[model samples]
Target: MGCAHGKCCNRDSSTSDEHSGHHQRGIRPYKNKDGLTQRSLELVHVPSHNFTLQYSSLTQHGYYPDTTDRENQDSFCIKTQIQGNPNVHFFGVFDGHGQYGAHCSNFVKDKLVEILSSDPTLLDDPLKAYNSAFLATNSELRDSEIDDALSGTTAITVLVVGDTLYVANVGDSRAVIAVKDGDRILAEDLSVDQTPFRKDEYDRVKLFGARVLSVDQVEGLKDPDIQHWGDEESHGGDPPRLWVPNGMYPGTAFTRSVGDSTAEKIGVIAVPEISIVRLTPSHLFFVVASDGVFEFLSSQTVVNMATAKVSYTLDFNACLLQNNATAYKDPSDACTAIAGDSYKRWLELENRTDDITIIIVQIKGLSNQSVVGTTDSEVHSRPCQTGGSMNQSAAIVPPLMHQKPLESVGHSSCSFLSLYIYIYLSHLFFIHCATRLVDLPYTWFLCFATCVIFFIVVPAYIQPLGEESSYYLCFLMIFFSK
Candidate 1:
C-alpha cells in the first residue's frame, strides 16, 4: 500500500511554467524502510482561474487504520489542451485491488495518459486510441516485474475533444454526466460497471469454464466443492465475484480489468467499454468516481449531491459579488464539497469506507468568467431538458434526494392494508385446502403459477412504484406463500 494523493507522480515531468517548476521541486523523492523508491507526488491543484479545462478531482482514503496507511489504491489525472490540441481534455479514475494495488493503479495513472498522448491515431480516431492505450498498458504491466497474478486495476477515462466526449471504461469504476433536461437534473451513466453480474460478462466467462459465484455460494462450498483463502466462512458480507474452477486463487470481483495475468486465463479481459457523447449546452457537468462513492450511492444521488454543491457555490459567489469580496474560491470547491459529502454518507452506510475519488468537469464553461457567472437558478430549474430534443414545458418530476432513504409516497395506506388483507385470505385458503388442492388435476401447476404470480411477476410488474415498495411487496409475497 502507498500514500493516497489527488495527482500523479511524474519522474520526467516537464516544467512549462513557473508554477510547474515549483510543483516539480516541491515533490521530494523518498525511499521507505524497505528501500523501495517511493513515488513522491503532489495533488495537481487546478485553480478555477488558471486551469485550461473545467474539471476538479479529489481522493480520500478508506476508514481508520486504512485511512492511517493512506494507501489509496485509486488514482486520477486531468490533462487539458493536450499536445497543442486545445479541444482535447482527458480525465481518468483508476481503482486497484490486491497486495500491490497501489503500484498497479499508480503505474496506469502515470502511463495511460502518456500512451494516449503519444498515439498518432488519437486525433483521427479517439476510440481506437483509447482502446490501444489500455491494451498496451496492460501488456506493459504483464511484462513488468510487478506480480499481477492476483492484482490488477480498474479504469474509467473521459476524453473530451472539441464537442465530442469519449468515455472508456474497464472494471467497476464509473463515469456519469449531469444532464439538464428542462428543470430537472438527470444522471446519464457514461461507463458501465464491468463485473461478473452483467449478463454479457457472465455469459462470456462461463464460456471459458469460469464460474461467477455469489458470496453465499463461496461460503457454502465444502472441501471438494471449493478451496479459498482466509476464513472458510464468510468474513464480511462480500459481493458476487468471479472465481476460478474449484479454486479461489484470484477472486476478482470485476469481469474486466488490467494486469491480472492469472485471471486472464479464465476470461478476465482488459478490453474497455467505450461510449461517445456529443456535448450540448444543456449538459451541466461530468462526474467520474471510483466504486467507493458509488457503492453507497446511486447515480442520481451523486448528481443531486453535486448539483447541491454547485448551487451552494453559486449562492456564495452571488453574495461575494454583492459585497465585492477580495477573497474568492475556485469552482473546484464544488468537487471537494461533493467528496466530503460522499465520505460522510459512506460512514453512515458501512463501518469501513473504501478509498473514494471524484472528478467534476464543468461543461457549460471552460473559463472562469462564464462558470462564475452561471448561477444556481438556471441549472436547478431544468433537470430533464436536453439540448434540442426534449420538451421544456413538461411537468417536473422532483429530483431524487440522496440525503435520506426513499419512501413510497404514491401508495396510500388504505391500498396497502387492502393488499395485506387479500394476501392473508389467500394464505388461509392455501392452508385450509392443502390436501384437497393437491388432488386437483393441475394442483402443482396452480401452486407454482400462483407463487410466481405473487412473487416474481407482481414485483416486476410493480417495480415502477419504487424499490422500497417493491421490497415490502416481496416480503409479503414470501410470507403469504409460506
Candidate 2:
C-alpha cells in the first residue's frame, strides 16, 4: 500500500525530490522568454472574441492511510492564447498512477500542450493535431528516463478555438458541460471514460492479449473465467483490471493512458477520444476533473453542484429579502465547492481519498452562430471513434451546436401559435362575460386571476418542468379558467 503502483512493484514510498508535497502549481505565474505568461490561474478575459471565459482550478492532495508521506500524483495546466491567438485557450487535468506517476503527469502536462500549440494546423484541423500531439507526447515519454513501465497518467483536456471546443480525453477523467434547456440546466458529457466497463474498450484490450479480471480472480479468490464487474458504479469492492496473460505485473484499470509502456502492449494506447462542441449561450459552463472527483459522482451531479444556486439577502428599506438568483457563481467558489464535495464523499466512502483536481470554466456572451458542421445529436449518437490514420478531411470534425431552447421538440412554432390562439380566445371570452355578468368586479377579478396564473404561475412552473407538455397544460389552464 505504501507504493504508488501498489502491487505492480515492491518499491518503498519515497516521494520525488522534484515534486514533494503539492508544490508544483500547474498554472505558474512565470513569464516565458517571449514575454508571454506561460500559464495562469487568475480570471481570463478575452475581449477580441465575442465570449468571455473566467476559469478557476483547484487540486488537493489525497489522504493515504498506508503511507505517512506520499506525493500527490495529480497535475493540471491552464494555458491561454495558444500561439498568441487570444481566441484559443487550453485546459487540462492529468491524474497520474504508479510509482513515478507524479513525474509522468507533470512531464506530460508541460509537453503535450506545447506540442499541440506548436502544430501549424491546430486551428484548421484540430482533430489531426490532437491525434499527432498525443501520440508524439507518448513517444517522448517512453524515450525519456521516466520509468513509465507500469506508471502513467490519464489526460482530459479541452481546447477552445473561437466559439468551438475541442475536448480530448484518455482514461477515466471527464469533462462535462452545463447546457441551459429553457429554465433547467442539463449536463452533457464531453468525453467518455476509457475503461474495462466499456464493452468496446474491454473487447479492444482483450484482442491485444489482455487478461481482464479483478484482483479476486487473479488471486484465485474468485472464478477467473467469469466476468464479475458490471459498471464502474456497481463494480462492488473490486473492479476489472487489465493485466498480461501470463503475469499480473501491470494492472491498470483504465484502457488508454499516456506512458504505461507495459500496459500499452496490452492495449493501453495514448490515442485520445476527441469530441467537438460549439459554444452557445445555452452552454453556461464546463467542468474538467480527474476520476477522483467523478469516481463517486456522476457528470450530472458535478454539473448540478457547479451550477447550484446560492441564496443571498438583499436589504430593501431595512427589510431583508432572500434572493435565490440562478446567476453563475464565481469560478473560484465553484471550484472550491466541487473539490470539497468530492473530498467529503471519498473520505465518507473509502476512508482515504484519491488526489482530486477540478477546473470550472464559465462561458458568457456567446453570439448565436449557425450550425456549421456535425450536429451534437449525430456526434453523440455515434460510437466512440479514435483519431489518427484518417485523412485530414476525415479527421476534421465540425463544431456541434446546441439546438435553440424554443426550437426543441414540443416547444415549436406550432406550439407557440396554438398558445397565442388560446390566449386570444380566452381574452375574447372574458370580454363577452364582462358585458353579460351583472357583477363587473367579479369578472375583472377573474380576469386578473387568469393573468396571474398564465403569466406568473404557468411560466414559473413550466420553466422548471422544461417540457412541452407543461406549456400545453398552461394553455389549457388559462382556457378553462377564463
Candidate 3:
C-alpha cells in the first residue's frame, strides 16, 4: 500500500467576534496527495442493494477564555465508495489536544482513511485491516513534521461494508447506535472509553511506569497513592490522569491516543478497540462524536435528543399507509441540535467548552429485507447490543434537553392556528383564479390542481420547511377545498 502524507497549511489566528455562533475559523479545506479535498463536513447519499445511508456532521469551537485565540481542534472525515465499492462507507471524528493539536488531528484524519481505502484486503478481513490501518496511521503521524511530543488526538470511526458496521475507537471519543425496540428507541454504546477509570487499562498503564493521579493529587492537594476515583459518571472528584513517574509533564487524561510521544512511553497506545455490529431493521441510526458531546450527556440522553427531532410511528398500519417511509428527521438538523446542546452544557458547567463535533447517520430501506453479517454471538460478545432492555425505565429528562417538535398542525397549536388562517386565505385566491379561468360550475379543476400542489409539491418541500409541515399543510388543504 502507498502511504502518501499531507501537509498542514497555516491558519489565521484571529478569533471570531460572535462567541455564540458556530466557530468557522477552525474549518479549513485539506487536500491530500490524491488531490481530493476534505472539509469539515460533507453531505452525501450512499445507496446499497439493501439500504441507503444518509449522513450529516457539525463542529463547534469551544469557549477558551483563558487562551489567546486558538483554532478549533476538532476534525472529521466522510468518504464514500471506499476502494471503489459502493456498498462501503466511512465516517470519523477526531478530537485533538495539546499545543499542536489541530495539525496532528488534520493529518491523522486525512491519512488514516486514505490508508484504509487503499488497502486491498479491507473487504475480506475488516478486523485485520482496521488494526493495520490504525498502527500505520500512528507511525505516519509520528514521522510527519508536526511536533507531537505532547500533543495528540482521540479518534472514533465507523466503517460500513454492506450490512455490517465496524467501529474503531481510541481515547475518549465515542460511537453509539439507536435500536428500535417495539415502540421505544434506545441507545447502545459501540465503544467503551479508554481511560484510567477502566481497571484493566489502569493496571496495564501502571505496569508500564505510569503514575495515575488527578490534578489535585499532582499538585499536593490530595494523596497520590490512593486510587479513589469511580467510573466516568459519578466520579464526583477530579478525574485521574496519567503522568510520568518523576515529573508532572505530559499529563493526559486518556489511556490511549495517537502521536503523544511523551505519554507513549507510559503505555498510552494508538491501538483501537474495534466492535462489529450487523445492521438490522431494528437499528435505526448511529452517532459518532467527540468526548465534547458526551461529557455531560448520557448515552441515553443523546439518543433521545436525536430521535426527538424525527417523528416515527410504531403502528404498522401507519407505516403501510405511508409506504414504509423512513427518516422522518433530517440528519443535519439532528447534528445541529446535538452540537448546540453540548456547547450550552459546557458553558453552564465550566465556563469553557471543548471542541464539539458530531456525525449522525440514519439507516433506511432495511425494513423490508433481511440483513446479513456476523452472528449474534459475535456481536453480543462486545459492547454492541440494543439499549432498550437496559434503559427501559430510565428517568425522563426535562423538556429543555429535548428537541422541540417541528412546527405543524397537531404538533404545535400556535403554529397550527396560524397555518389554518393562511390556508383559508390561499383557498380564496385559488377560487378566484378558478372563476377567472372557467365557469363557476366547473370549479372542480381548481380543486384537483390544489390537490396536486398539496400532495406532490408540498411534500417535496417538507425537508426545507421542517419534516412535519407537509402533513399539516395537506390536512388544511383538504378542509378548505371542501
Candidate 4:
C-alpha cells in the first residue's frame, strides 16, 4: 500500500555525507578458519556511565522444533577481550532458520570481534569494516549449494561508542535505539524489517520486475511497472507500482533479504542499506531490542515507562542524591527503579508480545519524562522523527547527573557464573521439549555430517572470501531429499 502511486523508498545515498568515507569498499570479504567461518561476539565496558545492559532471545518454538537439542546442535555465546578498544563493544542476534539459529550463531559469533579489530584502520572507519563483514559473509554463502542457501540466517548487531550507536543488519532481524531527553524518542531504527510494502523497500521491489511474475505472485510478488507520471513535471521516470493478483496488492511478501538471491535476479530486490545514528541524553533511554519486543510496544510507550520512573522518584536518597542522580547508585536495578514493575505496561498495552528481549542502556538526559505504554498510537507511529534539530517539540534533555561505577565489593564471579549456568540448563531442558513441535525430514538428519562440514568452513580462513567451487556431498543430498 505504501508505493501505490510508485516512488518506492529510493535513495541516492550519495548527497548525504557519509561521516566515515563512503567510497564503495569492495563487497564484504571472508576467509574461513579450519573448522569455522562466520561468527559474532560482544564486548561491554563501564567507562563511567550509570546503566544496566542485558540481552535475551527466543524463537518460534525454541530453535528447530523438530529435533532434540540435548543430543544435537545448540545456541552459543562468546565474550572476548579487546585489549586496546575499551569503549568499543559488540552485540549480535544471529537468527538461523531451517535447522536452527545455532549454526548461524556459531558461524558469526566467533568472527565478529576479530574482523572488527582486524584492520588498524577500523577505529577510523568502522562503517567500512561493517560493510566489509556483511559482504564477506554473503560471499561465503554463495559457495554453498541451494540447500545450504535455505539454511542461511539473518544478522543484526549494535556497537555503542560513548554517545554514538551504530548498527549493521542483514535480513529481517532488526535493531531499535530508544533515547530519553525530557521525553522518549526512538532515536533511530538501526534496521527495517525488509517487508515488501515499507517505503524504503519500494526500489528493491521494482528492481525485481519479471522474476516474481514467473513464480506467479504466490507470495506478494506480482506484475508491477505502472507509469508514475507526477503532473509530467516533478516526476518523469516510470514509477514502479506494487503489482498484485486479481489486480490487488499484497501479492508478494519479502522484497529484500540476504538469502533471497533466487528472488533478487527476477527484478525483485537488493540488499538493504545499513542504518546508523548517534545518541544524546535528551531521550530517557535506548533499547536495542528485537522485533519480538517492538511488535508489542511503541517506542514512546517505552520512553514514557522509563520517564514515569524518574518523575515519581522526584527525590533522591540523601547519601547518593548529591551529585549523581540519573540512576540508582547501582544501575542493575535501573529498570526496577524507573519502572517499579518492569515493563508491566507491556502486558496491559500491547496487542500481543513475543519473547520480549531488550538491552536497558542508560545515558545522560533530562529528568522530565512521559509515561507512554506499548499501545500509544504516537509511540507506535514513527518512533524517531527524522532530520536533526528540527525535532525541537520532542523532549529537550540534558544529562541530569554526573556518573559513578558500582563497586562489586564482595561479589563472587564464580557464583554469578553458576547461577547463569543453572538457569541456562533449565532453559535448554524446556527448549528440548519445545523443539518437537516442528516436523523435520530424514534428509536433515542424514545430511547432518555434511551440514557439519559445511558449517565448519565458515569461520576458518578460507581464501577468496567470496566465491567457491565446492558443492560437496550435501549438494546431492538436497536433490534426493526433494
Best by the lDDT measure: 2
| Cα lDDT tens digits for candidate 3, 407-461 | 1112322245444554565567467556665766657876678656744575455
TM-score of 4: 0.46
Q: What is the lDDT of residue 63 in candidate 4?
A: 16
- Candidate 2: residue 187 Cα off by (Å): 1.1
The segments of candidate 1 whose C-alpha lies over 4 angstroms from its true place after superposition are 1-52, 64-70, 221-237, 309-331, 366-482
Q: In order, what lDDT does every prediction score? A: 0.57, 0.67, 0.66, 0.36
What residue runs in model 4 are displaced by over 4 Å at the alpha carbon?
A: 1-83, 99-102, 144-146, 183-188, 210-253, 264-272, 302-357, 364-482
Clashing pairs in 2: none
Residues 1-482, candidate 2: write the lDDT tens digits.
11123333222111122332232323221111111011223555443345688777777667656753554666777777676655567889888787677667777887887797789877567788999999999998888767778777889999887677889998989998877654456678899999888999999999999999877788898899997587787676477888898986687888999988989898999999998876767777889888878888788677767765632224211111125433345777777777888889988878677777788888877667432232223111111111101101112346533432112122222345555654565566556555666466587777677667655665554554545655576456566555
Top candidate on TM-score is 2
Candidate 2 wrongly placed segments (more than 4 Å):
1-41, 46-49, 310-324, 369-397, 400-482
Worst 10 residues of 2 by lDDT: 384-393
Q: After superposition, how far is residue 228 of candidate 3 from its true place, in Å?
A: 2.0
Better of 1 and 2 by lDDT: 2
Q: Tell me the deviation in Å of residue 154 in model 1.
A: 0.6
